[model samples]
Target chain A: MKKYIWDGIFKNNPVLVLMIGLCPTVAVSTTVQNALGMGVAVLFVLTMSNLTISLLRPMVPESIRIPIFIIVISTFVTITDYVMHAYAPAIHKNLGIFVPLIVVNCIILGRAEAFASKHTPLPAILDGIGSGIGFTLAILGMAIIRELLGSGKLAGHIVLGTKFAATPILFFSLPPGAFLAIAVLIALTRLRK
Target chain B: MIRMIRSLVLVCVVAAGLLSWVYLFTKDRIEEDTRQKVRANLVELLGDTTLTFKPVIPDTLWEFYRDTTKLGIIFRSYGKGYGGPIPVLVALSMDTTILAIRPATPAEGLKETPGLGTKVTEPDFTNQFKNKKPSQIKLKKDGGEIDAITGATISSRGVVEAVQVGIAKYLKYLR
Candidate 1:
């Protein structure tokens, strides 16, 4: 149990170690608020999809398993999208097309194919949770640096005051800045290893 | 082969059932929320006066009155932006001048590129339309009064075009 948790969250972190879902991690990590929003949505979709796929693993035939898993994952993604659109419309709008794009987030599908299809339901659920958290934490690190430098705000509140906020390093909020931030973080993590 | 088909069908049916239940649960709330959002946006733009909304075209033009006095008309305009459709909400005074022009939902509608075209949502861009007549709404490069966003001439033009056409329609409809 602990092994699965440790495996997904740290040792085999999806964003950092496995490097599967970098698209959204970079695209939406401009702000702490947005990163958190994406993280929560991914968490819900991942856990639900993983659980459903694991339970259906036996009945799902090998030849048609990939398509079947996709169907199951998309079902959960649509549910998450609608629920968020209905209730948390602000986050939905901010996240934009990425909500539906969760169907292809890769982390969710990767886990479904690699872990969920072969693992028990409980282990699959844990993997989903751990990987989701790992992804969230990884993006949060990038968001903190980006938001702090890019906008001088922490979750929309002014943190750096007039001095830094006046002439914010706008580069940090753009795509290139996302890459720079992630590269530096990845380098730091490598130093520890 | 038959077993494969059966398994696929069973999985699909179960997934469909679960999703349908969610759709049923959220349908009304989503509808209510959308209407409420549009209403809130209207109230925010028009202010807390005794404004009544009468749909001229239901989602296109709405006739709003403040305490039996005709205030103005609120209508939606679509601009073909770089990203896609940029929907702007235009409020015109009874005299045909723009009272306010805001992004329709404030968040959605404009999927303009981040930093460049997306600057269309910034007050520096949208604020240029406030109180301006349609004739004065075009970009400076096009011999109009407005200034285009740096490096985003197309997106700037899109907003102006949407507002210009929208006001023309409003005038024609009024006539």
Candidate 2:
């Protein structure tokens, strides 16, 4: 049980190890706030979809399992979209199409097929949570580095202070910066292993 | 095959039911949020929360009034930008001098490139339009007073043209 949770964080870390769901990781990690928002949204969708898929696994016919999983996942994504837009309009606006695009995130669908469809509800949820945490940590790390170097701000606050006053390296805030940060992070993880 | 079809139908029906419930629950709040944001933007642009807005053209143009006195007018305009149409909200006082201008937010479908073109929405860019006449509303390169963003000439130009064209179309309504 513990292994199910820990494996996702350390062994099969989604962004660092599994490399699924990279689109949002790169797109929204420009800001730590955005990264956290995306992380939480993914967590909720993943956990709920995992639970629903596990519960329905026995009854879901083998021939049509993929489509049923999609139906379930998309339902949860839509719910998350509505709830976020209603309550967290600022972050919802910042996230833009990425919120709706969550329906197609491979992590949720991957788990549904590999873990949730076979596991009991409890373990399926734990795996969902573990994967979610792993994803969040990876993206959050990227956001901190990107936001700090790219804009000299941390969660929108100027942490580097006015004294440090060289113009921020704008490269860290663009798409190439996202790619470079991810590559360096992956390399560091590999070195540690 | 029969079982597969049955299960798929059942899952879809259940999903649809759940989605409809959520949609119904959130619909009103979403609309209210939008209205509140528009009001806030109007207040910010006009710099006066006390002013009441009367629609001159029902979502296209508005007239701001403080009691019996007419304050100014605000209208929507669009600029052809790199990403797509950039909607701009422009406010002009009774004399036809610009009061303030704002670009559509990302939520309102402004799709300029983040950190580059999106800077056009920032105050540094939008504030340039304030207190300027329509004739002065062009990028410095085009022999006008406003300056374009360092790397976002297209977006900056879009807002300038949007305000220019908007003023041309809506200024007559002020009189």
Per-model tally of clashing residue pairs: 0, 0
TM-score for each candidate, following the candidate numbering: 0.85, 0.82
Q: TM-score of chain B only, all predictions?
A: 0.80, 0.81
TM-score of model 1 vs. true structure = 0.85
Mark the regions of model 1 whose C-alpha exceeds 4 Å error after superposition: A160-162, B44-50, B79-86, B95-97, B103-107, B111-160, B168-175
Encode model 1's per-residue lDDT on B116-154: one tens digit a residue: 888877888778888887788889989998999999888
For candidate 1 chain A, which ten residues in a row score worst on lDDT? A184-193
Q: Which ten-residue region of model 1 chain B has the weakest summed lDDT? A: B102-111
Q: Local error of candidate 2 at A84, Å?
A: 1.7
- Rate residue A144 of model 2 by lDDT: 97
Which lDDT tens digits does candidate 1 get at residues A154-190? Answer: 9998899978988999999999999999999888777
Q: Lowest-lDDT window of 10 residues in candidate 2 chain B?
A: B53-62
Enumerate the candidates' DockQ scores in order: 0.70, 0.75
Deviation of model 1 at A116, angstroms:
0.8
Error of 2 at B34 (Å): 1.8
